[model samples]
Target: MNPIDDMDADPIDVASHWCLQLADGRLQGDALARFQTWLDEDPRHRAAFDTVARTWQAFDASPAAPSLMAMREEALSHYARRQSRRWRRPAGMRRPMLAAVAACLLLAVAGWGWIQAQPDVYRTGLGERQLVRLDDGSQLSLDADTQVEVRYNHDRRQLVLRQGRARFQVMRDPLRPFSVSAGDRTVVATGTEFSVELLAAQVHVVLYEGSVDVLPRDAATSPPPSASPPSPSTVHRAREMRLVPGQELVAGIDAADARIREVDAPRTRGWESGQLSFNDEPLGQAIERMNRYAGSHVLATGDVPSASLRISGTFTAGDNEAFVEGITGVFPVTVREEGPRYVFVQRPGTSTPEEKMTTQ
Candidate 1:
């Protein structure tokens, strides 16, 4: 019986094998075309790819995940060595028994290589900013105080956001697309520029130029009909959304709902200009931004939070303590330093802090 046709072989195993083969950069012409066809032939191909992608993301967080592609290549090379070594083991008086040993050798080769060549290369520490030039000549601007890992090879160019936000200006390559993984979806692009921010419970993508194709991680994991009901076609899964400049798409924490809208993105990106901008930003959000950017603690826990507020201002980068005091001047607040952070209180006579306010 052909090894490829063995009924006991797991579909996941086959998919992983194919993913390795595709990522190995050896397939060409008909062989490559056939692999592509196979990937599109069944849903399992996609599921395997997703697993590979998630594994890639998990590896980004792990010290050993970054070098996975290299390890896979090494493992394949060793498997070939194992195959070559198999025939050299005497005349093989026990043919059937020897085949099992040969298979074991190959498995051992792959497994040991995988274990030993684990990835653990890249990482960013808190309050760190990283700038990376992608394989396609695009630029990645990592936001302050975040971490991420990258794997760019012949087959796939991927970035896993471990924390914080990043702005990507992707160079175009349809044959080899660029993708960024954050939360439950992956943002795929073709020569487009976009910024993706991963907060505690949300993933936000704001396009500055070009367009991005947002695809959910589970897009291909819909369960196969357990009983083959009358409706035999695949479920109408969510399609990718093309976000243009000034457009933003947000996916909730649980991925229950994804939202897209248009806004003044340039103004939203005021932080890049050494100043954080808010256009009627809520009191809570403004505080969160301050906390994220300030090396010193900046909390909005005073009377400033309970009442409505609206603010539009450009602040200097350093001396956040002074900046908080300046905010009091604009909005009628009394500011004081408690420890290293600033807290705001309503100007005793003014109305209570509004529930909502905008900062621009």
Candidate 2:
């Protein structure tokens, strides 16, 4: 066999080879250390290894696993007999060849099964809050009109948020990182509780407990400017930011106006329990959010000045009437029914001098 073939293979292919070796349950001492060192050598190596692990884990979850394992045992015995008869083959080469054969046996049995074992897609209707429990004991709480696709492999747990908001309570797995992709950013964690919301071009992240790293989608693929890349240990060298508990990171998909700031973590998740809390949020923005859970459309009209005013309060979701009444009590505006929509307009004769000047 040409040694150059193995050297030229991608890390993912190499990682799969290593996975097969470990599955044979024969490696000890030096072999194990070398595997660990290879994992630590590069982030791509770990990612590749995780992909192989995911495929294996998916097989374990399949109903055909038991029968497949039985076949694998039979194949191992048959291969052992064949190898015993080849006396001219070097002893050192025999074991390595046997390992490769064992992996092929598994692939033959479950190649299609592995692809079918990908995670399920979940969605919630408007104004609905649904909770989902994953196979790995992790919990996902999806907010109104939300969509998420979940996939767990032996090496990593991943979720893709297509839109809306969701809270994640991830179980701890040191070897396999948990990541959620939204817009142009990926939020990675080991074990933590957090919430993510997609608004316009922004991916809003709130870390309630533990820690998470917000990274650009291409952070793993793009190498640095220099000829040599940074070591895997220097994870911070990538264009990423680590967020601690009680912090918020808003990443812009356009790569502009991204910001990290502190917030009341409890208030951020209040929507999960039917409580909507806003802290000095703009009236227009607040109304748009509340409309997510509302049946009757609330429209801003007449005086645009009041739309930019800051408002703060806690109200129940779907209670648009109460919210409008509350706003009118404090602000110089009134809510009136116009067909199917409730329009907020400036109160008659209440326009400020600045507003009048601007209008003229």
Candidate 3:
């Protein structure tokens, strides 16, 4: 019987069947095609198969595996003997049944092992980038000066962006949604691509593909406060927002301010390629991002209204000199060398940069 035809069969059982066939080098040609079709038909199929395959590989290295195998054989033999007397089944049919039983036993052991596993932490230093391939086939691209903690179990896959930024290309697991928590907000996804940045006073979420729900982390899990009724602003701050591709959502870390706007999603990922692309971004925020890659930090000082100055351009990640020149050339801003740091101040006898630039 074709395995795929058994639609009512347990997914784990089908996965175990494929694992066994592949392990003994039985899947080839048409059998390989069928396996691929089944895998692509549902995300859960691939997830189950990965779990079973990992368990099969781990079995050889386990110290108690020999004793466990002995116990399984002893039990199978006793069952086979009882079955032979009752139904007198053919030996050929019994062997397949015995193998399926063994696979389920192995899966049970794998589940216990997964529950005992510890969370993994990944970090990147200043001006460094790291690409991490998770066990479940998801990929994480960490930007400079970033730290993330990944915890995966049978129930869910969770990550915390401790600092900085990272992009996630999540693998689809219908039973387990992927979630990344940054500050008080959490971005939840299922088989999607998105980036989450923990800024100084805001959490920025940019969705590149699929959709994500940005919500307060405690809203769903924590019990409602009983001491006093929350103000309207407090309730509004805790409200969830859904983001689609090409949309950017910025939520305040210390304030109840949140806003969403259309953005060039691809431009937001320029940092992954050692490029910083900004589209009318605040000068201070852009400078903060540049400092992540700079040996000498850039500081906005003096009577310069840096907050009101917006910059638009693309610059190399670590090119501090070029960034300084770019701003000085366009805006009425002067760069003063102060040891290793560069201080930006308003040029003498010049109008505000934004007003001057707008007039031109």
Number of the predicted model whose lDDT against the real structure is largest = 3
Which prediction has more favorable lDDT, 1 or 2?
2
TM-score of 2: 0.59
lDDT per residue as tens, model 2, 81-147 = 5344443443333656655665553552254244437568999877898999998899999988889
Q: Per-residue CA lDDT of candidate 1, range 160-261, in tens?
A: 777777888888887666788788877877688888877766788888887677777555222212221112122223445556678778776556567677
**Steric clash count of candidate 2:** 2
Off by over 4 Å in 1: 1-128, 220-240, 300-311, 330-336, 344-352, 355-360
Query: Would you list the C-alpha lDDT of every candidate in the order shown?
Result: 0.59, 0.69, 0.74
Name model 3 segments beyond 4 Å from true: 1-118, 220-238, 296-303, 355-360
- Residue 172, model 3, lDDT: 94
The residue-by-residue lDDT of candidate 3 on 1-360, one tens digit each, is 334466766566677566556545566779877887898889999887776555454653562687656755665565455444444565433678887756654654454345347568999988999999998999999999999999986768889999999999999997888899998888888799999999887788899998777778775343223332222212245466677788887887956666777788888999999998877667777787888887566555456676678777788998888888777887888988877789888888987766322111
Ranked by TM-score, the better of candidates 1 and 3 is 3
Return the lDDT, model 2, position 72.
44
